[model samples]
Target chain A: MVRLITHNLLACHVKGCTTNNFPLVFQDVQVELQVAEFNPDFIRNMLSRLEWTALVNAAKQVGDTSLPPEQPDMMDDELLQKLHHVLMEIHVTDGAMVCQNCNHIYPISNGIPNMLLAEHEIG
Target chain B: MIPTPDLSHLTRHDLEQVYDPAEDTFLLLDALEQEAEALRKERPLICLEVGSGSGCVSAFLGKIFGQSSSLYLCTDINKHATRCTLATGKQNKILLDPITCSLAGPLSSRLCHAVDVLLFNPPYVPTDTDEASSAQSSADIAGSWAGGIDGMEITNRLLQDVECLLSPRGRFYLVALKQNDVPSIQSRMLEDFGLTSQVVIERRAGREFLLIIRFARTAHSGSGSTS
Candidate 1:
């Protein structure tokens, strides 16, 4: 299940495939929209942990341009609601998360992404 | 006391394929409550739960740690478990990142030595090795309880990786049955990973003697020690 919250922290870990591995590109993504309860406090608290730029880029890649390019200095209710939808409501049901650096393709089937690498890919 | 996550969203049909909260889950919750003070003091940033069948444990943990302080990453081999977990988190107002993967899977390498608090209430029932393997391959409710060969087959694999997954001050809580040989497990962790452990809580439910064991780096083991 690729949520922006999980995707935000994920990077390509293919053996020595290190630098520029972050923000695995979402390709042929099949999005599932499920409405989650909106909680301003939860979204406010999550802001600090998120990589603003990476999340924004990933959101755009998945065709969700709701978030701004820059993280707002002051979080307002409206922005927090948008953040909630982007982070919690949207689920990537099926697709492949391709690494920009290593070009390793992690496929997602039935809402589960296969992050297992070949034996040689293990470091 | 932390409340159990609202599982009202899960229908009977959903529970048929997913493992519903059982005595083992409650035991883990009780152990967490016992260590609530220390856990808050540790101020963990990342918490990962393996085989998070119903997300009950992790959602309870979210309440103890508060909503915003840490990232709750939960994994279960069963796809339905992952979906149920997500819904449980939402119903409880806890944002959990539920990944459908087999016991840490792709996140292991990236999370090396980064997990602050880890939890696992694995399949600990003794069953035939072939049955366990098949259940695991099927990734259904059977995978939740069909522990192969003394119920250590799934647990042993995670034990080997615990040292690499835990941070210097990280703590791991595991639910085990008496039949699983708890003494040997504690000794092995001590010798191989230098992780000291103590039984946090124990209860006898039906035929199962449920035990919650807490493990941490030897130097920080004092935090969980009753003495």
Candidate 2:
């Protein structure tokens, strides 16, 4: 499934589709909320790896506006909990991840994102 | 060797649904341990684990390779396995990206020739074709050990993609049973994909003889051969 953590690292892999490929736009998504055990340290460690702006934007797109627009310097419990929920709880069951640059749509069915491209789209 | 990922967070309830680390899992870990030096030397950028049940193997890999350098991507058809994998990674301080899909379903095309380390400990138990298909479609714990018809049904499908997935210096590790016909698998990969392989480790656990086989492209051969 497309979780924010996984989505954070994904970019449009279409041939010659490089710039502005990140943060694939989620459309018609079916979100399932699962509660994972909260671990502040884990979230704190993940902060450096995350694309903060992209995560907040993606969260907003998925109707989760809990995260602040910018990543706060202080590692507060409130922010960590929000990050945990955004990254771990939310699951995109059904949708298409549309690439911003290529307009290539990678569909998610049965909670699996089909990242495969056409033979011609192979880089 | 890097310590195995801490799975204390996973409860018995969770283990009931997901495939817990067992003999097969440990064999894969040992195989990875055997190749630790070579893997570090190659400096893999991307590591993909197909059917990452319980996430132990991948987490161990992340620990060995260092989390910052490579992207640790994992796939499993079972949703519970994916969740367990995520939790395991978190507990171990490894950033594992677990995707709930069947055998690199969506990742194959994009990851073409980009995966530097590929790992799979598939369902190698012999069973009827229907049972295996049902288990796979159900995406449950049964899918963890219900290989059909000589236990190659699922492995066969993945073997077709190995050549496409591996980078030039890539390494693939597979866990199999004696009944799975290890020799044929190695020969087939060599003939069809030009991939050479050797048995890295083997142990008899009860009636099942488990083997960990390592496969790599012919050009990258002399560095890590453990027959």
Q: Please, what are the lDDT tens digits per residue for candidate 2 over residues B32-100?
A: 898899899886767899999899999999899776556689988887888888788879987677776
In the range A21-121, model 1's lDDT, one tens digit per residue, is: 88789999999897876767657755665689988988997889999898889988889989988987788989999999989998887666766555568
What are the per-residue Cα lDDT tens digits for candidate 1 across B105-221? Answer: 767766777788999998999999999988887789999999999999999989999999987788999999999999999999999989999999999999889999999997754
Give model 1's docking category. Answer: acceptable
TM-score of 1: 0.79
Give each model's whole-structure lDDT: 0.85, 0.83
Candidate 2 error regions (>4 Å)? A1-24, A28-123, B220-227
Q: Best by DockQ, which number?
A: 1
Model 2 shows how many backbone clashes?
0
- List the candidate 1 regions with Cα displacement exceeding 4 Å: A11-23, A30-94, A99-123, B220-227
lDDT minimum window of 10 residues, candidate 2 chain A: A110-119
Model 1 residue A121 CA deviation (Å) reads 9.9
